[model samples]
Target chain A: MYRVALRMLLGDKTKCLGLVFGVAFSTLLVCQQMSIFFGLLGRASSVVNDVREADIWVMDPSVKTIDVPYPLRALELPRVRGVEGVAWAVPFFKATVQVRTHQGMLENAIILGIDDASLVGVPDAFVVGSIDDLAEPDAIAVNPAGFRLLFPGEELDVGRELELNDSRAKIVAIVDAAPAFAANLTIYTRYSLATQYTNNGRNQLSFILAKSADGTPPEVVAERIAARTGLKSVTSQQLRRESIMYVLANTGIPVSFGTVVILGAIIGVAIVGLTFNQFVMENIKQYAALKAIGVRNVKLLFMTLGQAAFVGVIGYGIGLGIAALFFSTVPKKSDALRGFYLLPEVAVGVAILAAVIVILSTLISMRRVLTVDPATVFRG
Target chain B: MTTATDTLAVRCTGIHKSFGEGEARVHVLRGTDFDARTGEMTFLVGPSGCGKTTLISVLGAILSCDDGEVDVLGHDLRALSSGKLADFRLANLGFIFQQFNLLPALSATENASIPLVARGESVKAAETSAREMLESLGMGDQVHKMPAQLSGGQQQRVAIARALVHSPRILICDEPTASLDAATGNTVMGLLRDAALAGDRSVIIVTHDNRIFDFADRIHHMADGVITHIESPDSSREDAP
Candidate 1:
C-alpha cells in the first residue's frame, strides 16, 4: 500500500515536482537568510572575540557595544588592576583615524593600541611579520584585509608605510584579525605611540583589558571591578552577547531578515497545500475505490503521511546542499562576504520547519481522503 | 446435499435506507428483502436511481442501512463495528467497479494484487497470486502494463482478477459491463460467470446491460426501491406480490 501511494505520487510528475520545489525554495530562503543574519551578528562582536587573552573588559558605564566605546579615565585602569582576583591589567586604546596611502588614497581605519610591554590585546595570528616587530619605533601591524584596502594590488609584505594623523607609520606585520562590523582598516600599535597619534584630550583610555587569577571566574572579577571602580565591566562572552543584542535591539537587520524568513514559510505552506489538495482532488475516485476495496482509513492515512515524508526529505536534502555550497564557496571568493557561514543549529532548525510545512500540508489533504464516500466508486 | 437456503451467501430482510432529511429526503431502499445463494451468479437489474447500486452497497457492507437484518457469509454485518466490518470485507468480499477503478499508476498485476495486499499479504506474494489469476483470465501478456496501456476489456479482466485474487467467498460488482462494447461486455460476463460457479463462491452484480442476461443463474428485477420479480434463465419467471 505504501508502494502504491508512492507510485501514485510519482505518476503525476508535474505535481510531485511542484511539491518538492515549494519545500526546497522555502528551506533555501530561510537557511540562507538566517545564516547571513547570524553571520552579521557575529561580525558585531568580532573585536571582542579577536582579543582572546582578555577575560574581562572595563570601560565607561555608558558603553553598550564594542563599536561605540566610551573611554574611561587613565586612573580607572589602576583601580581595575587593584581589584582582588585580578591577575593582570593593561591599557587598551581604540580610536578611528584617517590613513593616507603612498599612492595618495585616503581611507578610514581603526587604530587599536595594545600595552607596550605585554602586547596583550594584539591579534594572535600574524600573516607577514612576528609579534616582536611591533616593538620597533613607529612600527604597527595591519590586518590582511585592511592592508589590501590600503595597498590595492600589493603583495602582503611588511615594508609598507602610511601617513596617519600627519605622522609617518610603518606597517611591520600583516595580522589575520577577525573581520569587524564596518570592515574598516585595522591597525595595531603600542599604547604610547597610539596616544601620540590621537589627540583626544586628557582621558584617552578606551578600555582596561584584564585577566582573572586562577580558579576565579571572569564574571566575579568583573563584578568586583564594577563595584570598586564604578565603571562598566563585563566578561568577554558577556560583551560578545551584549554586542549582538545591541545590534538586534537598535538595528533593522532583524526585521528585514525575519520578514524574508516568514514570507518563505508562508509561500511554502500555500504552494504545498494547494498542490497537495489538487493532487488529492484529482485522485479522489481512486481513493474511493481503495476505500471500497477494503482499505481502512487508517491505512490510507499512513500512505498519505508516507508521501509527505518522502517529499520533505528529498526537498530538504537538495535545499541544504545548495545552502552549504553557498556558504563554502561564496565567503572564499568575495572579501565582503568573508567570515559568513551556515551554522549547524540553523540547519537543524530549518529541517524541523520543513517537516512542519510538509506535515501540515499532508494533514490538510488527508481530510478530503478520509471523508470521501466509497460508494462514489459505484457511480462511475 | 446442501439445500439452496443452507448455502445462502447474503440474506437481507426489510432493509431501509434513505439520504438527506426533511423536505429533501429521498428514500433509496424501502423495506426490501433480498438473497443470493452460494455457487450461483445473482444479477440485480434496474434503471438508474432505482436502488440497485444501493442494495449492492449494503450487501457489500460498505454502507449501513437504516434498519435491516443483513447477514453475509453466515456473519451478521450489523454486529460488526466499522473497523471490524472493514476487516470482514477484506477477508471475505471483493468488489469490481463500473469504471474498473484500477489505480492508473500501478501495473495490471499490482492493481490486481490490491485485495491481497490490503489483507496483509506481502506484495511479492500477492503479485504472484494476482499473476496466476490474471493468466487464468487470459491476460497473461498484459500483467506488466499500466491501466492506461490496457484496453477496456483488458482493464475489466484485471478488475475481475483483482476481485478473485483473494479467493473471496462473495464477489460484488456494480455496472461491470457498462463501459465496454457488446463483445467485450460478453467476454467479461463470461469470465465473471466462470468465477462464480467454480467454487462455493457467490457473485452478485448490479448491471443495466441486458445483452449478458443469459450469464445469470437468477435475475432480480427492481423498481421503485423494491425487487419486482425474479427470473430464472432455465425456467419460468416468478412475479412478486
Candidate 2:
C-alpha cells in the first residue's frame, strides 16, 4: 500500500512537486528569518561577550542593556572590591561622544576606558602596537570597522589622530573588535584620558568589572556585591540574558519576524492542502475501488500518512540544507553578517513546524477518503 | 426461517433501497428477492435505471439496504459490524468494474495483485500469483504494462485476473463488457465463465450487453426495481432456436 501510495503520489509530477515546494519554501523562510532575528538580538549583548575575563558586572540599579549604560560613581569600584569573594574589581568607563575625523566630518563614537594600570578591559586582538602603547599621552585604540567608518578606504596604520570633545587624541594601536549593537565606532583609551576626552564630571565610571575569588562561584559573589553595595550585580550569563530580554521587550523584532513565520505556515497549508486534496479527488474512483475491495479504512489512512511523511522529511531536509548554505554564503558580502549560525533548538523547532504543516495539509484528503462510499465506484 | 443451502452462494430477501430525499426521492430497489447458486454465472439484465446495478451493489454489501435481509456466503451482512463485514468481503468476495478501474499508476500485474495484497499477501508472493494467473489467461506479455498502455480488452482481462486472484467464492461485476467490442466482450465473458465455473464459485454480472448473454448459466431479468423472471441459458437457447 505504501508502494501504491508513492506511485500514485509521484504519478502526477506537477502536484507532487508543488507539495514539496510548499513545505520547503515555508521551512526556509521561517528558519532563516528566525536565525537572523536571533543573531541580531545576540548583538545586543556583544559587549558582555567581548569582555571575557570578567565573572560579574556591577552597575547602577537602573542599567538594562549594555547600550543603555547608567554611569556609576568612581567610588563604587573600591566598595565592590571590598565585598567577600571578590578577587579584584576594576573601574570601567563607557560614554558616547562625538569625534571629528581628519576629513572634518563629526562621527558618533563609543568610548571605552580600561583601568590605566592593568588595561584589563582592552580588546583581546590587536592589529598594530600592543597595549603598552596606550601609556603614550592622548593615545587610543580603534577597531578596523570603526576605523573604516571614521576614514573610509584609508590604509590601516597606527598614529592616526582625531579630535574628541575638542581634545586631540592619537590612534596608537588598532583593536580587532566586533561592531556593537549601538552601531558606533568603539574607542579604547586609558581611564583618566577617557574622562578628560569625554569631559564628563568626576563620577564618570560606568561599571565595575569584577572577578570571583578561587572556589567562589560568580553568582554568589554577584549576590554579595549587590547586597552589600546596594547596586545591581549580575553574572555574565545573567547580564547577557537580561540584555536580550530588554531588546525583546522594547522592540518589535519578534512580532515582525513572527508575522512572516505565520504567513509562511499559512501559505504552506494552503498550497499543500489544495494540491493533496486535488490529487485525492482525481483518484477518488481508484480509492473507492480499493475501499470496495475491502481495504480497511485504517490501512488507507496509514497510506495517506506515509505519503505525507515522505514529502515532509524530504522537503524539510532540502529546505534546511539550503538555509545552512545561506548562512554560510551570505557573510562574505558584509561583516555585519558575521557570527551567524543556526541554533540546534531552532532546527528542532523548524522540523516540528514542517511536520505539522505536512500533517495539516493531508487532513482534508484523509477525511474525504474515509467518508467516500465504496458504491461510488459503481456509479455512472 | 431462512435456510442456507450448501449450494446457495447468496440469499437476499425482500431487499429495499432508496436514493435522495424529499421531492427528489427515488426508491431504487423495491421488495427485491434474489439469489445466486454456486457453480453458476448469473446475469441480471435490465434497461437503464431499472435498478440492476443497485441490486448487485446491495448483494455485494457495498451499500446497505433500507430494509430486509442479505446473507452472503453464510453470514448475515446486517448482523455483522462494518469492520467484520469488511473482513468478510476481503476474505470471501471480489469485484470487477466496467471501466476496468485499474489504478493508472500501477502496472497490470500490480493492479491484478490488489485482492491478494488486500488479503495481506506480501508484494512478492502476490505478484507471483498474479503473474501466473495473467499468464494462464494469455495476458503474460502485458503484465508489466501500465493500464494506459493496454487495450480495453487487455485491461478488462487484468480486471478479471484481479477478481479471481484471491480465490473468492462470490464475484460481482457491474457492466463488465459494456465498453468492449463484441469479439472482445466474448473473450472477457469466456474468461469470466471459465474462472467462475471452475470451482464452487458464483459470478453475478449486471450488464446491458446482449452479445455475452450466451455465457451466462442463469439469466435473471429485472425491471423497475423487481426481478421479472429467472431462466436457464439452455431454456433460453431452446426458445431462441
Instruction: Return the top candidate by DockQ.
Output: 1
Q: What local lDDT does model 2 show for residue A104?
A: 89
lDDT of 2 by residue, B143-210 (tens): 99999999999999999898889999998999989889998988888888787767468888998888
User: Model 2 Cα displacement at B182 (Å)?
Assistant: 1.8
lDDT of 2 by residue, A1-380 (tens): 88888888888889889988888998898889889888888878877887888889999999988888887877888899899999999988888889897788788888889899888887688988888999999999987767877887777689888999889999999887666777648899999999999878867889899999999999999999999999999999999999999989999988998899999889988988999999899998998999889888898998899889988998898889889888888854455676677777778999999989889878888999999998888875
Clashing pairs in 2: none
Which residues of candidate 2, in runs, are more than 4 Å off? A98-107, A122-176, B1-6, B21-24, B236-241
Pick out the ten consecutive residues of candidate 2 chain B with the lowest summed lDDT.
Answer: B232-241
Error of 2 at A227 (Å): 2.4
Report the C-alpha lDDT of model 1 over A147-231, residue by residue, as the tens digit.
Answer: 8787777788988789999998999998888678865588899999888878777889998999999999999999999999889
Residue B32, model 2: Cα distance from true site in angstroms: 1.3
Residue B3, model 1: Cα distance from true site in angstroms: 12
- Per residue, candidate 1 scores C-alpha lDDT tens digits across B3-80 of 133488999998999999999999999988899999888889988999998899888988999998999988988888
